[model samples]
Target chain A: MYGIDSSPIRKAFELARTIENPINLSIGQPHFPCPPNIIDAMAEAAREGKTAYTLTGGIPELKEAMARKFLSENGIKYATPDRILVTSGISSALFLLFNALVNPDDECLVISPYFLMYPSMLKFYGAKVLTVKESFGTDDLNSFRKKKIKLIIFSNPSNPTGKVLSKEQLTALANLAEETGAYLISDEIYELFDYDKKFYSIGKDYDKTITLTGFSKTYNMTGLRLATILAPEEVIKALTTLQQYTVVCAPSVTQWAGIEALKTDMSSYIQDYREKRDFVYESLKDFYPLEKSGGAFYYFLKVPIQDEEFTKLAITSKKLILVPGFIFCENKDHVRLSFATEWDNLKRGMTALQELSKELAN
Target chain B: MYGIDSSPIRKAFELARTIENPINLSIGQPHFPCPPNIIDAMAEAAREGKTAYTLTGGIPELKEAMARKFLSENGIKYATPDRILVTSGISSALFLLFNALVNPDDECLVISPYFLMYPSMLKFYGAKVLTVKESFGTDDLNSFRKKKIKLIIFSNPSNPTGKVLSKEQLTALANLAEETGAYLISDEIYELFDYDKKFYSIGKDYDKTITLTGFSKTYNMTGLRLATILAPEEVIKALTTLQQYTVVCAPSVTQWAGIEALKTDMSSYIQDYREKRDFVYESLKDFYPLEKSGGAFYYFLKVPIQDEEFTKLAITSKKLILVPGFIFCENKDHVRLSFATEWDNLKRGMTALQELSKELAN
Candidate 1:
């Protein structure tokens, strides 16, 4: 009966509701609406009475589409439709995988500044979580090898810092997972948001890697809640069984829309996010200690004041909402600012953040 | 990591898929399409760009509507919007609640023949499950009192049995729960299908009751996957936090449709199910030992032979799929037959079942 506290990001959402016309840079989802064609497809599915439960894993059409997406795009030839288990979202896939694999007191390694759900869910299942910083090199492998880690997990084109891992880094991590007999879990929900076109799937090189990607972020259909997991057939079977008892299946109409989503090109949308990412990084780098975000629409800015204090001040003085970095990791000096808003709001939010930092420095 | 096997129901579905023209009496969901108006509302919501993640518990609109439904129809006065958690489905609601409440080796009581997930989920959380027969009298309370059961869960209009508990029976269970300090979870997903007009919610008389109901059965939207749990505010908060890390939120378009589902009248659909229930029961009662289902469009008929053997013969000889009772309970002398199909299918399926039973009896 251990209790889980609500995430601080939700508290930020609550705080934003109190502000009038807040320049909110705290959302993790795309600002754009889902494409019209995908929406129409979903509506058509409902109208055509495709509103009953699909099979436990998912409909064959969606799984086949995902299998092709994995092989052609991700370079993972082993991801046949049988190896893909469609889930409600990557969050649920992680939930199911963690439940299937992590036992009490099992050592699990998570890359630092991880997606908030990763640590929270692992701990919920009683895993002893060991976090390795995002900047870990090949030398980091030697230390973790002795721990016999059961699983290693991280989100690519990372959520808070938007730092995409290099191919060399991914290879080293995969090698480490192999040495330690640990399953690698790659959360590639931000795959399509890679501004530098440098995104690589660890699953392409590793047999034990569990790759999770979904339609939510790429298509701006987060509410539809559909995702796919490419894994070993044994893993897929276990997760599908878990899904049958948990989520049952992903939403049927949304699964239908996912077929259309795979067909809809998102290059223009990705281009817009790339421009926004560049704008946010360029505008803030001189004012604050920041790294250029290579992918995803976020800039983790190191603020002059405490992250929480600075966030509060920004909301109070400038009506801006930013997520304090403590919720994502142990870095209280950094605050995560999502550039996934309108161009006007992004500019206003960035300017407000600059003015607040100047005031705090003075 | 304990492995969970796929349920027998899924195996039945897989077997049904292999047959050319299977009469799927084993299917748990309604055969009817979702109402056109509800489907239209879902489509309209998607078209309106309501396709982003909602608040963890659910949208305020749906929760408010659920609160109204609970208060007016269920006589649950304390179920304000804040006390309700919208989940992917009742299965997910059960998952979250079980994760939140059940500790390792905790004692849990389930009334048998229970929904398969009840025992499986409880055991997944390491509960020592105690089953009280469905025909348990008030005297049965004395035996369970000493067991120190932490929770008691059962579906009203029970999934396998379809036997709606009398008000006295519900009161006795509630009183037993009160005396033992155990939380009572009343899954009322089939509340609308109470053919006897004898449905009663324990939440009306008990403070510790958690009432779960959903639109899946009433609106014929099993694939849309939306349900609500009316519980204490503290319990709701915990489940909501868990949901945020798991399913994230119920599908957004479906949540909008839920508001419409609440408004649409479903009496005609319930009447249709009632008639179908009568048709199936009357047709088979003389041939087989059957209890007329009081709710939820199912009959648990005592079979003339072993449950599995009878189910196999029916499927082989008659292209009929009936669920063996062993999946739902310890009894092997019974099978569950759903009467949720069309009039033609129900009639044909009933005749086939009757012939199969006679052949087996001979």
Candidate 2:
């Protein structure tokens, strides 16, 4: 038995799929070719017969490379190989974390409009999930301090809204977690996609914060299915133990490729992504009421019509797919638009949204 | 921040790793190249840019191949493509199944001296694990009937012991589960390694039984990381939800390769494994007391000394690696030896083990 409800992003797409030829924008995956170096490395590994089970945590060389990458990119320090746990992806890491930390009925706090999978992961282990609401423009600091939470999960460049938390905000949250003995699960998978401001992590402040990052978004290696969880020595031990029952390790070849991806120059890819982000932010300004996205490849645009109705109308009239905000438990007048697709595709999709907006206004 | 202690298998291995140059017999992995054809397929997929997120359950073509595979090879019938949830591996499948079936503190039954990971997986989710101890030579049927197990977990061609349950035994257990509303999670990962007899899955008698099988062991594609959980409609729905929080899908490039693996002729690889199994079996017969392994790629041997002391002595006197049996929670006099290595390596390891037995006897 598997937990299907944990995939609201996917389910949202699937539900829209049942409609006549909808432009599905519900899932949050990049639509680009994976980096050349990583693909080459994977092909090499596969051909060389590196197909046996790797170490349960991960390969040493890959782990060492990841350690270097984290230090260079995030300015965080973790020496022992035992501090990292390679995972299938962030999804499996989340499952392992929830299973290990949340004793049955233990309460976990999540900011409202969080990734839908967070609640499902908690619910799968029978952990109590509490939602702390934040207004669309509310300061994250005040919203986060309202409750004593056991574990708080947040994306550095927040999902659904593309709202990046500042370094000070991250440090404040980390302090609160330390004061209350709560753990912070900082998802920084989109660390490289910030257009202007740099992304910050709670892990930089407290050792209790577990940082989840991967090559999926940055290198467009989603199918390679590699991710890592960085935590304190004790948390790493516990998560490593839990991972043994799920994925023994990330794919060996993928981990090898991950090493290459981490080592390569990624500025060109970020430059390309920033171009798309800029194009979407500028193009959508006239069509939809929106908050400017700070980082990541998505725009949380406020549509003129109800989010669900607007998505439906766009799908029917323009073949444009956009995710309604209800999936993330946000107000119904908003939609999440991923700009990870090609700029041409984004142009076409944006034009369709404009046409749909005019028709609804008339 | 992550739950790592939930893995007893890694703990057992980690403990063994502490022993200076300990011979490890604790892993449940096949030691061989993934079939050359499968490797080629993976390389081809990578070359063709099959490097994006596949459908959540899995690629349609792979699921179709799997359906045909079960029908033609295992004589099982199923048509619901939606009922199969492809996983990163069988380990993730088990983790998902526990989440779907076991509520916190609810009971899940496991056969004792079984695969060590089951208890940890159940316990990680806070499920009360009830072990029904089975003496090596005695029937475990009566014990299976007595437990009020909401979920039952076992590996066919049992892990650690290499014992295969008879059809009658499986049918009786299936009938018991059917009567009790228990969902059986049968891990048939080792199904292809059965040498003495064909594997019997509880799925034959109980549609509610969730079957987990993978290419890791069968095709030596462990590093490729492909596995799937087959279940009835309701179980599949729940599992899909659980996997949404765990892993979205098995690696796509690997899944493409796996489809080819299932379609290609695998008799030669199995034939090679059979040879290795026999070579190791006969080589060690004169030195250590061993129960004839009915199936799977291991020789569960009984030693005169305590498992830990024998393991230590073997490591000190010889450069041999063998997994101690106490880790499996069974007869402390026993040890589990994997015969999955290359023929020459198996022979070399066996020779060293034989010399250690003689030295210990003196």
Candidate 3:
């Protein structure tokens, strides 16, 4: 039988489709449409007849731009184009990286509250997903020392938690990985959304680090489905080969759009997300025990009732679409709320949450 | 450390990058640019801001068109959208299908002179690739009864061999698979390129048959990275879940373009490939013992010298690019040449190959 259907997130989405007129704050993509400039560039590519497969890894221009971005933006330096791979998305890049490094029966380290896909995908690969239920704590880092882990994977400016790992924390994890001869695979897809702090990529300092990030979140082109992975030559080679037998290459027309996206001044987009972050923080700070996350578009709030029960009640009573926190981890007392929507939709969803809070208080 | 670097096809491509202005008969894509109509459709999608993620399976319209296309063109009928999955390409569809059906150590049957990716990808998933060294013979069908195969995967309009499985042979394979409880996956990407015989898809006659085909060869949209997998519900659900954690969905704008592509009359494209196939067959029939293939755009010829030796001599002496036979299997007597290029380029490569043949005969 297909094992993924049993997962809580999958079940939640299945339940979601049955409800009528639901306010969906469950998706993890930017609510804004992709900018006109980026869209125009893609159209221009289509007009210019640029719709053919590039080299398996990437187009030369995109690769060069990505390399330059790593050095100037993420503060990571690479020697050549061989060190980078343009992927179908951050998701595809992660899939390939995990397959390259992990084997069946190998324990792959993951931190929970995590993205729903990590454990599910690792299970598909027949690897033992050893979930550590803490942030970047040194104890959690040290706890896995005796166990042979194929890789330690986490998202910075995290998916559910929106907890950005500190520079010192990332470096410590990097050092631990190097010391243990294990690879550190980081999903930095939300790197551009860090509001309070400047993001630090562990790949900047670590040789064994494989960084997965892309244009989707930063450029609001999730539908375009284009991203990149940066790693050393050995890992890049492995991922590239896997890619050839898989998606072959990123969408060429979208890759051209990505070049335009990188060139565009997206200060406005980041500034807008920062404002939404503040608005959501102010709206919910009193209703629940919550953290003002530094980056990404999600907030994990400890709810008054069991998370799944709360989700069921919200869906049945208010038609509010939200994911139970237990889907991300074993934490049954929380729910994840995404602020990646327009202010109007966010306000409507929050109003329903406010009513739910009052009804529960009664 | 990268396992794929050692594969001969990968090595051949690597060797290709170094040679200057080689007469290339090695590429496997159509030489023509994507038709202007399809390009216009994609640009229209971008202009309309359709560059966002669709449901993991695909957009509703595209799925409907695919279901209709399968019924009318391939003679396979599925009741609903759930039976069809739009993939990044046939390559990604096969990758997802194999991961769903197999685990490490499970045996999967494949034919020799197969597409390079089939066995290579199976190995990546830790599946045992049992490559049968025969064409579609019912006698060879019994060869796999002793082993419990997870699936039997092959390309119709075969890759290197260019040997299209006749309707009778396909029906026999379908029956054998059903009796043996093995899933049959047919790669019908080249169905449109068939010159003589009408293409027969095993999916038409069998319930468990998984069909992998796409718009790449038919429409010259390989760069768009769009394809489909038509299978039963149980497998469709599994593949859909795998897709969510891999590439989220096919590129959104391209899927719109796909809808347009399906609606357009593509008789002219087929007419062009038919002529090219005939030209290659007529040109090479006398020079070497070549099979006049009914479908696909490749010619597998038994060259006079050892395949690797011939390939090396041709590349170094004449600056001609070609793949040796042993790359697909251990058959050292042949070489695989693609006629997917325009007639002028094909003539140039064939001329070089002809001179080399004469020199070898001397």
Candidate 4:
């Protein structure tokens, strides 16, 4: 279990923190501060001494707000807070859901270019991850009918690739899940980051779908450690059972911050990320075979050399940090460049990437 | 499994929350504010935008502070941050440590009346819990020497019982672990609540011991969701690997608060709880077969009737909430009353308890 390389991102993050004037494109942290209102809400909650454990599932107010969000944003109506489980983060939400749904030797499906934690958490629970050689939005599970996947965990508005699932794709996924009696677990943390297409959640159509999203990227509050899981009532109950032994609840003060965060407008941050996505595409589009970033602030840039070599070069020579795509997927042909840092840092990172690409060409 | 009745305390908490002026002694929350410095530190952290994910183990500042604490307070010298892991809470810390240490069907020893989550989490991991019918401080491990126990998990300055482990008991356990190649996990979350005892952590003597403690009880900041594990370097490394996928890291803002919390004086709060423990023991001693309160704010009071029935009667008739001892142990003969509420509420809860005892006797 400890064999998994959980260190690359952390290593890069650590290296970035130490180097002077280094451009850190390795992590997907929001450039802006946590919304002032939400931060104030947390401070206010602490001042009010709201520092005791909430119910194992979550605070009622945060769950209620999250239910409201599920109805308005995703068209999925959770009539009450019973179906929502506030998690420490999307990371922990996935951990609990996998532990709740998975058993030893259970076959779970994952799409290629998946998040690292998906396989790691599944493996921790003694479940096997069978990867489908399909893109995030366009999943082809017909061949895997014999595999009998108990659950399918994949990301929408994909990390590393920034691919958003189409509504039709989500509909197909919901239909397949219902047909196969397998649950579709969608992680939509990047829903608010989508630029080209409307964000679609399979949970809208599939009762078995569990959509995980959080305040991490949307409010630039990853450190606040608040996330939401909207699932079938039974699934939520099961997850809460595991969480009672895990977190008890998301931090109470942060849940209060989440209550306020749901009320704050994020149009400005959304528009700004859309602009940066466009800028990153235009800047590196010429030399690197970078995909159009539809949602998340990342481009899985196909490097001229092996991703590991280029990442090392970028770190040592150009003082730029990028994650090798092998951590995200089976292939090591690409390095993920994140444009979620400050404008100055992103610009400097782009220059380093361009230099690395030029040097590799010679 | 979701079959476990996880809602007894929550049910009482919900009931208590709804009724105006209800005396709630159900949850183990401290009836005090977080130290002012820690609260200010958290607010300051948010203002400074320290809301991004830190290293998976913890922020370096917090880990360093914890290492310092291990040496100064516990007299166990970590000498480096590598041996300390900052977790979301003692709850999450246990979840990670068990994931890292306990294997499926491993024989783990638990002292009777162990913290509820220990067996729950161990069971979640498919480990068998072997209860040693002994008090927290005194254990007879001679019979268990032949049983190949992989680990021993128990609480010191225990929650329901408020029993502080003696130095000789810790030394014997440590020696047993060393001799048998079994690990000793000492949960010292209640370390600060000890009334007339000097808390002696097993890790001070045994390197094979992993000592778990946290800021939640010590600083009256359970909502902060911060804790520490001082363990062997290898165990810390393994747990860090799991935490990367579990919580990612303890919340960065709270870690800042923890840094300040490490420096704040907890003498006043400790003294306050000590006095409350005394007040509670004095008031309830003649009525219930209550032991003299030693540590923590709880007393495992023997009831005249079955604890569950008496608990229900108190809640329904007197608008008081208390936890039955069966939640902590196999017996239904006792109820656990917490003196961690405000003095007025605690006094009221005591009155309710006295009345319930009289009524039950009749």
Q: Give the best candidate by lDDT.
A: 1
Candidate 3 TM-score to native:
0.94
**Tens-digit lDDT track for model 1 on B155-224?**
8898999989888878888988888888899999999999888999889888678999988987889999
What TM-score does candidate 4 get on C-alpha atoms? 0.95
Candidate 3 residue runs with Cα over 4 Å from true position = A6-21, A130-142, A145-147, B1-20, B103-107, B125-147
- For each model in turn, which proportion of the native inter-chain contacts is also found? 0.85, 0.77, 0.80, 0.77
Clashing pairs in 1: none
Best by TM-score: 1
- Per-residue lDDT tens digits for candidate 3, residues B255-300, read 9999998887867767877787787777777778876777777888
What digit string (tens of lDDT, one per residue) describes model 2 on residues B121-156?
Answer: 677577887766544222555565565769877788
Kindly report which residue stretches of model 1 are placed more than 4 angstroms away from their true locations once superposed: A1-3, B1-3
Q: Global lDDT of each model?
A: 0.89, 0.75, 0.81, 0.82
The window of 10 residues in a row where model 2 chain B has the poorest summed lDDT is B1-10
lDDT score at residue B344, model 2, on the 0-100 scale: 65
Docking class of 2: medium
DockQ of each: 0.75, 0.56, 0.64, 0.74
Best by DockQ: 1
If ranked by lDDT, best first, what sequence of candidates would result?
Answer: 1, 4, 3, 2
DockQ of predicted candidate 3: 0.64
- Superior candidate under TM-score, 1 versus 2: 1
Between candidates 1 and 3, name the one with more favorable DockQ.
1
Error of 2 at A48 (Å): 2.6
List ranges where model 2 is wrong by over 4 Å.
A1-8, A15-27, A77-82, A103-112, A123-147, A205-208, B1-27, B104-109, B124-147, B286-288, B356-362
